[model samples]
Target: SQQGEEDPQALSIQEGENATMNCSYKTSINNLQWYRQNSGRGLVHLILIRSNEREKHSGRLRVTLDTSKKSSSLLITASRAADTASYFCATVTSRLDSGAGSYQLTFGKGTKLSVIP
Candidate 1:
């Protein structure tokens, strides 16, 4: 089953603008993380918010989590054209089989952002 689903799907904006993206998921998660991916490249870790954390910030990025609503949001302040990329949210889910237990990580569809200078 799918876990996280990114909202907006895609976004476009001019340089120096701010961007906001959201993620919604099903099931309990240990933590939620945000990552950025440029075209044809690996994902880069941006920030992580634990289930108990309400909000966090790093540089121009800010993240908020609401376990009650099973939702999270990422906000980018003063976005630049260089910031153009795909953003994804990841969550940890676990499964038990045959009295054994294992954990898995799932990522959202991603929100693609295009920034024009």
Candidate 2:
């Protein structure tokens, strides 16, 4: 299923604004990662684009990928409050009986950002 599912599970802005999130998946993937967790802290690797690559950025974050509209969007520009947390989008295929080519990561149900302050 490509671990797709991220559509405003929760969000509350304040400290500097700018925070968009959206992720959807189903199948077909070689690389597509974006992680950041800062509540209890421990999941940070915000950047990884492959599968032909569409768009990608770092400092301030800015990612975009269409894949024929499979969906993928995450932009956090002037945001602060430590940039809140919870923003995942991992997708790396290969496992249809051990193809040995995947990175093994399927997480969604994120987008819980709350940079109030």
Candidate 3:
């Protein structure tokens, strides 16, 4: 099942400002992950906080999880032009039969964030 659908299809902000995005999911998950996808580029992992974890942060990114409601939020502090990208939240899950590092990550459509210089 799909997880983490963000509100607001797009958002625009000036460089140095902060950006916020919210995501809501529909199922029980092992972990929730956030990623950034630049225009015409691959998605990069920003942070992954397990269902057991309520909050996590990395550099300028802050994320919070509320399993009770199956929702999460992302905040980017002091946004940069470099931060202009589509931010996605995904579900990181594991199946006992897999031989990989242990999880398959599925991403949502994402919130397109534009930061102007």
Per-model C-alpha RMSD: 1.6, 10.8, 2.1
Candidate achieving higher lDDT, 2 or 3: 3
The lDDT leader among the candidates is 1
Native-structure RMSD, model 1: 1.6
In order of listing, the candidates' clash counts read 0, 0, 0
Selected candidate, larger TM-score, 2 vs 3: 3
Rank ordering of all candidates by TM-score, starting from the highest: 1, 3, 2
User: Between which residue pairs do clashes occur in model 2?
Assistant: none
Write candidate 1's Cα lDDT for 4-110 as tens digits. Answer: 99999999988889999999999999999999999999999999999999999999999999999999999999988899999999997776552567767799999
lDDT of 2 by residue, 3-53 (tens): 778878888999888899989888778878888888877898889888788
Model 3 lDDT, full chain set:
0.89
> Distance (Å) between predicted and true CA of 29, model 3?
0.8
Best by TM-score: 1
Q: What is the lDDT of candidate 1?
A: 0.94
* Tens digits of lDDT, candidate 3, 15-115: 99999998988878899988889999998989989899998888889999999998999999999998999999998767558776587777788999999
- lDDT values for all models: 0.94, 0.83, 0.89
- Candidate 3 least-lDDT 10 residues: 92-101
